[model samples]
Target: MTFVEELREHAELAGAPLPQLSDGRDRYGPVAAILFAQRSFASVRRRSNGTTLVTVWDHRGELAAWGQAPAVDDVVNTLRAWQDGVPLPELCSAVARYLQAGDPAAAIETLWSVLTDDGEPHLHAIVAAASADPTLRALRPWVSHGTLHLLHATDAVHGVRRGLAFHPTDEDAFKVHVYDGPIGPVQDVASAAATAAATAATW
Candidate 1:
């Protein structure tokens, strides 16, 4: 089967339909538009028009709850905070330090740290179709157990993985590695559902 077909099958299993890729206008925003969502829950998307849209999708993939934010910066900040599972006050302090650093890459690095930090209750199943590994299949249940968070459709960028110690051995090929985050945290269903909804809108 083709890559798209395979991705569709996996997405179906996750109950999170793949976003539309044909429309240039709706494809992911600039590199700054980082994505975060819980499988089959809610999502948040930063639109091209500078609006952050939060949406909640029901089991049928239909919109359930929706909200728009004109204050895009604030919305993005909130989303990042949620992903980090940190208190708002703490995140605000960290953002303040990051902003004072006056470096864009630093900001991206900070965000990447939160998303893929140790035991992040999320699993990233990045595997090459031709590879010999079938481990990803066994881990699929993590999504249902709320142990999995973001399901990256593709591997992250080079710089994004630099500080996280997640370099792929085959720089040219996809590989799978299991990352452990802080243990046994409950899934924030309400927040995830909203974020998933926003992500679905972008598709």
Candidate 2:
């Protein structure tokens, strides 16, 4: 069966509502179900000027909801296509949002899996944005310090990791190894230090 069909079957088993063109119709529930069944879905809310607010999910049900709804289908469809291409990091990111909205613990777990899977650096980016639990922060040590450090730096550039730390406080106390990239550092230590400090303070 096609992915959409498989998703429909699962939605039926899960008793989720499906998607519909209009909200007033009884079939709307099924349409909602279909949208919810997959890790990603969009809610079209009509507004002034025939626009909509499209809420996209990241696994946790915590939607990175966006406005300007009428054009959302194109965005959502593009994302779905990316998932078919070996699990884009953004898919995991969306799923992370979904989990965070509903169950933070599950979101963290899902984010962790997404990170370790295929060693996708993008997972680090997603986890940085989606999770803020202290326990999850503790797990960062297991990640290569160099990689984490680099991510910490890049996170600064993108403002991704809001409240996480590169290393535990007492810099001298942590015996962490740094991973050197083949090229000259794309990120400077000062920037990374500032980013790490910010993360430590917020999350």
Best by TM-score: 2
Model 1: lDDT of residue 122 = 24
Tens digits of per-residue lDDT for model 2 on 1-203?
54344444544454542332223211111122124334444433333454433334445333333323234343344334333442434543553222123343443343344344323343344234323444334332223332343233223223444333344323222212232312222333344344444444444
Model 1 TM-score, all chains together: 0.21
Error of 1 at 157 (Å): 35
Q: lDDT tens string, model 1, 1-203?
A: 64334434555464544443111111111222223344223344444566555433334332333345445344344344434454334543553222222233333332332233221222332212111122221111112222222232232332122111122223232222223332222223333333333432333
Model 2 alpha-carbon drift over 4 Å, by segment: 1-101, 119-194
Model 1: residues with Cα > 4 Å off, grouped in runs? 1-36, 39-50, 58-60, 81-203
